[model samples]
Target: MEEVIENKFIAIKSHINGAPIEFDFEVKTETISLSAKSKEVIVKNLYVSIDPYQLHRMKSCSSSQTTIYLAAPVQPGQSIDTYGVGRVVASGRPDFAKDDLVVGLLAWGEYTVVEEGRLLNKLDPMGLPLPYHVGPLGFSGLTAYAGFFEICKPKKGENVFVSAASGSVGSLVGQYAKLFGCHVVGCAGSQKKVDLLKEKLGFDDAFNYKDETDLNSALKRYFPNGIDIYFDNVGGEMLEAAVANMNKFGRVALCGVISEYTGGGKRPALEMLDVVYKRITIQGFLAADHTKNYGDFISTITDHLRTGKMQALCDISHGLESIPSAFVGLFRGDNIGKKIVQIAHE
Candidate 1:
């Protein structure tokens, strides 16, 4: 016999032009079948991640427009989907069963029905917190790993710089660079975040960008010999500063451009002559494109996390009702590490 369940989901109320607010989203209820269709699975969401990239999809972009990478514009009434971790409640696939933990693109809701193929990875529960899978072991962690190692091609004893240093991806990137024997410095939006980078995450040094009048001078102060590798999370001025301070043959992994996301048209003017003289290589990459390295990321980061070689920090809000505030908080710099909403606890 099939069981029926009433699910509450967060949906966009309308197209947003600027920063997202709490009223921009609405919670709606829908009834769903507990039994999944063939090749599908019903998951009870445990944790859902709120990322900055999703802000790009909240606008009313053209249907034919595909400028935003790995994301599509969310329709007014559509449920928002992002990275999350959940437990299987019912399955119609041979590989999945009830109570099995999984991680993937889950809706911002208490429950979701998804095809088995959409599963990113199954959770192992290796005595680690469930949220760790979505934080350090999930997309954010993978982004850090791939961006730092594969894109940056870091060398030992090199000087590394990270923008948005206290962010989920940038935080891990700084730690990873430090582990690779690099002298790392990061820039964050707040003093507390800067302290977290230097004191908690072991960054060689970090500064609050809000306190710095001249970003270029700040970068120069941090990287006296010039940066060998830059893991760029925020674009615009920070990127311009990093480019100006980059060493010859320096590598830059352009992970994201959060500064231009919301109606903020603040694009920084870069000095092209600096690029010419430095011979800098800047590469923009998406973690999804590097899915082939997922296994290696999991194993390497998992070991670091388990043995305390790495630290995973998460700013979590409780309940599905907090989803909107939590999602909006990312833009406000309200989170320290990974921003997550805990829908239900296992």
Candidate 2:
């Protein structure tokens, strides 16, 4: 007789419109029959990344609208959507086998059965940190690399500004700009993050956005000459201020607009006249669109990682049970770097 292991999962119990996530715990069987196992692999999840973008998808948006579908809404009572690293426990497929490590989309559970497309290329866990696959070398790293080099064509001696600068992607953006000889200025919500950006992350200048009552004045004070590149993460009022202070032919990488992700009410609007007057180019992008360049990105970033040229900071929460709180912390700006959940390995 084939041996089976019991599994436990945490799933969303209901849809939340404008608040912290709600979840329910359930126990279930880990393995399926032969036919089901043939198409899918059962994996023991190791770590889950807590990202601000996930909060945007947790809400139930009407599918009837075509103009606004940033992310697919999570079905009520289903497993929450996230990227995780796992070890394959059982596999009927030839490409993967038991004990193989993988990183890709996975449910927020101890064990999960998933079809193949979401799985990433098998990784060699030796000589590398596991959390880097989730942080600097993972999704956040890709976003920062692509946003800076691809979307925003930075020149030497350019003045660059990044919002939410101590978070996952922002810290890297600032560093990359500095490497290219651009003067980097960053804004964070708290004083601690500001210190991390300037003292630790090597930003030329940084400030607590929360402390600045007049955002436009703050931008002027920081970049009296005007910003040449803007890496926008928190969009809304700060974006508007960035636009008002941009130089001629400035570029803006619209990586994420976390400001509009929550609450059912009206989203904040931006003033677009600056795009015309300043000849500013603002482009929105997703990491999925840049997979072709992953090899190139990994080569450059990994080299930096090996040398002391680049550094990564991670804010990890322990256990699968802390998933909801880890996610909630992103909104409250409770995390210093990348927010991640560490599931125990048995």
Candidate 3:
């Protein structure tokens, strides 16, 4: 007889429209059998990623849904699936077996049943922490690598600017720019994050965007000459400022717009005249769209981490109970790095 497991997972009480509060989420319990069907696997989740983007998935109607199948919205009471690291407990799949460590889209709860066509694969920890697999070595790393090198296409000695520089993807992008010989500058919401970018992440310069009343002037101050590449994670005013300060033929990799994600910030009225006159190229990219570079990214980033050329700043909260608060912290600028919840200790 198969043993039944009581799984505690996060579910929304209602679809959120504005910034999510802790009250928006609730813990729900379910009973599952320790069994798997053919081509399916049951995984005990360890670390689930806590991301601001998850807010979009909780919305009743969001543009994110149309952009990618992964961003499809979930209704109230449905399990919130996120990228995470887990240990396989039961498997009917030939490639995966018991005790295999895997990383991919898993539920926010204690266990996830992965079926065919879902993103799940065995993970090689490479002597790094399991949390690293959830952050720097996982979704965040891929997003930074692809958006900077693939979309921005940086050049040596070029001026590179990153918004939300202290966060997961932005921090890695700044490090990669520095390693590639590009002059890098980053902006964060707080002074602590600015210092982390400059002192720890090896960025040439970093500043608190909130301190500057005029964002355009701030950009001009940082990139005195002009910016060659702009990794935009925060849109609205910052995007407009970056566009105004970009040099001719500059590239903008539109990653995520943290500013407007929850519909709080006003839409940016960018100067289209500057965009046209400067001949700038602005492109939006998702990490999922750049899977071709995954092999190279893992190899290169692993080497960088091993050699001390890169540093991963991760902020982790413990237990499934912390999921809601950890997510809400992103908007409050309470986290200095990647915000992740350690669901279970490995």
Candidate 4:
């Protein structure tokens, strides 16, 4: 007789229009047999990532307006899905077997049944921390790498700036720019994050955006000669200021606009005259579009990690029930680096 296992997962109470709250998610349980169908696998989730972009998946949208990059919106009663690292407990697929550690798109649940098409990639851990796969070595890391190199096209000794500088992707962007021989400056919401950027991440300079009364002046103070490359994570006023202070032929890698993700607000108006006069190039890129560079990114970043050239930081929450708060914290800037939930221990 097949034994039944009770699985707990998170589901949206309803589609949200503004910022998500703790009440938006609900924990539910279902019983499943410890068996997988052909071409499917049952996984026990270990670590799940809580990223700002996941908010897009929680909104309700019409068919024509439902175009979201990389993910689709979650239905009211359906379980929410995100990238995670898991251990396979049961597999009906020939390639995957029991106890196989994998990293891929799994739901915010204790156990998940995944079909072949949903798997993103398998993991080897490789003497690194398991959570590192979901942090520096995972999607966020890839995002920082591709957005900086492919989009920004940075040059040695260039003046670089990153917004939301202590978060997962932005933190790495700052460090990468420094290692590339650029003068890196970053902005974060709090003094602690500023310290992390300057002292820990090796950013040339960093400041608390919350303390700045005039963002344009603040940027000018840091980039006296004008910014040559801007890795934009929190758009809006920061982007406007960056544009106003960018050097001619500058590059803007539009990685994310976390500011607009929650709380309905008018889009920040930019002075196009500056954009035209400066000849700045702004490009929005999705990391999924640059999977071809994953191998190169892994090889290069791994070497940096092995040596002391780069650092990866993770802010982890324990247990499945902590998923809601952990996820909501990203928008509030409550986390220092990568915000993740640890569902179980290896």
TM-score of each: 0.96, 0.92, 0.98, 0.97
Would you list the C-alpha lDDT of every candidate in the order shown? 0.87, 0.80, 0.92, 0.89
Instruction: Give the alpha carbon lDDT tens digit for every residue of 1-346 in model 4.
Output: 8878999999889997788999998999899778788888899999999988877777786342356435677788787778899999999988888999999988899998898788545688888898889999989999999999999998999999999999999999998999999999999998988988888999999999989999999999999999999999988889999999999999999988889887664476888987888888999888888999999999988889889899989999999999989988888899988988999998
lDDT, candidate 2, 1-346, per-residue tens:
6666666666556565675643422322344433336668877788878887765555666332233333567665566657778888778678888889888777777776878665555777545678888888888999999999999999999999999998999988998999889999999998888988888889999999889999999999999999999999988888888988999999999998777667532353556777887789989988777888799988888888788787888888888778777777787788877887888662
Best by lDDT: 3
- Candidate 4 achieves a global lDDT of 0.89
Q: Measured by TM-score, how close is model 4 to the native structure? A: 0.97
Best by TM-score: 3
Model 3 has an lDDT value of 0.92
* Clash list (residue pairs), candidate 3: none
Measured with C-alpha atoms, the lDDT of residue 239 in candidate 4 is 93
Tens digit of per-residue lDDT, candidate 3, span 180-268: 99999999988778888888888999998889999999888889999999999988999999999999999999998889988889688
Task: Evaluate model 2: give its lDDT.
Answer: 0.80
Q: How would the candidate models be sorted by lDDT, starting from the highest?
A: 3, 4, 1, 2
Q: List ranges where model 2 is wrong by over 4 Å.
A: 21-36, 62-70, 264-269
